[model samples]
Target: LAKTTQPISMDSYEGQEVNITCSHNNIATNDYITWYQQFPSQGPRFIIQGYKTKVTNEVASLFIPADRKSSTLSLPRVSLSDTAVYYCLVVRYNQGGKLIFGQGTELSVKP
Candidate 1:
């Protein structure tokens, strides 16, 4: 797994959109970029994944630049409930389908 770097914290008022970016300079060929969202007490929930270009789901949109060295997670119309820690993990297919975790970005949704 490749180590990723992301912002420690971000402040956003309720109903505003928030974008969290991550950088992974040495990602392996087999590694896939995956994003997760974590509220204070609960475990992270899968937000999105991408190998190239863009991928979007109900929760967020992932934008991977041409270099693939960094990516962005875009949260639209965020609200107080959207306040959570965002994690970016470089995951590769592994035995038993297990994946590793990297320190994530903590997003504070203000009211």
Candidate 2:
């Protein structure tokens, strides 16, 4: 399994855009980038997944550069409720229960 690294924390203001980047230098060519977000008292949840280009949802957008060594999770016009810890994971398509979790990035959205 590859290790996904993130910053200890980040800060943003309400209505501001927040971009959190993660690095996966050892990620396999077949691996996919999975972005997860967590609330203050809840388990981390999958936010988005992508191999290249961009994937966007109502809540967030994921950008995977061509090189695939890193990815950025973008939250547009973030609100106070968007404050949470985010994680980026490099995972095999169907290798269940094999992923390892590292310290994630804690994003603080201030009012």
Candidate 3:
């Protein structure tokens, strides 16, 4: 299993761009990088995922370097409602693997 590390907390103002990065130095070849966001008392919601390159969705973008050791989740122009705890996960799908969640980075979006 690849151990992932991320910031403990982050702060940003409303309508500002926020980028949270995760480092997985021992990531495996078959492992795919995924990110999730959770509000207080709510389950984590999927934000984005990437294999090797950049992947962009309507809400956020995921950028992975060539080495696949790290990935970044970028939220464009975040609002006050975006304040939540963000989780970074490394998983191998189709293998019945359990999802292990680490202490996520708490993002505080202030107005």
Candidate 4:
């Protein structure tokens, strides 16, 4: 699998919805799309995961295109407390659950 490309930063007002998208044009057959949320000074928290179509959970929704080349993570009505960095990762077994943190997309929620 290849590396993912995502935005460097995004800004949203409080109570607004935010969507972050990433592209992995060289994604492999065994790769899965996973989203993680991280606040400053803390580890990334698993937000959602999907291999195809849509997967929704309590915190977010992950929409993966059929080609498995890209994915979008949707956060509904984000608040100031939701300000954090969001990461899109290509899940690979060889990674040993060790995340390779890229320059994550910084999500800023303004009051």
State which candidate has the highest TM-score. Answer: 3
lDDT of 2: 0.87
What are the runs in model 3 whose C-alpha is more than 4 Å off? none
lDDT tens per residue, model 2, 1-111: 778888999999999999999998888877888888889778888899898899998889999888888899999999999888888888886767355778899999999
How high a TM-score does candidate 2 get?
0.93
Model 1 worst lDDT run, 10 consecutive residues: 94-103
Encode model 4's per-residue lDDT on 1-111: one tens digit a residue: 569999999999988989999998988887788888899899888899898999998889988888989899999999998899999988777656555567889999999
**Candidate 4 Cα misplacement greater than 4 A, ranges:** 94-97
In model 2, the runs with Cα more than 4 Å from the true position are none
Q: TM-score per candidate, in order?
A: 0.92, 0.93, 0.97, 0.93
Cα lDDT tens digits, model 1, 22-63, are: 999988777789988899779778889999999988888999
Instruction: Name the top lDDT candidate.
Output: 3
Give the clashing pairs for model 1: none
Error of 2 at 99 (Å): 2.7
Candidates in order have lDDT scores of 0.86, 0.87, 0.93, 0.87
**Which candidate do you rate higher for TM-score, 3 or 4?**
3
Model 3 lDDT at residue 9: 99
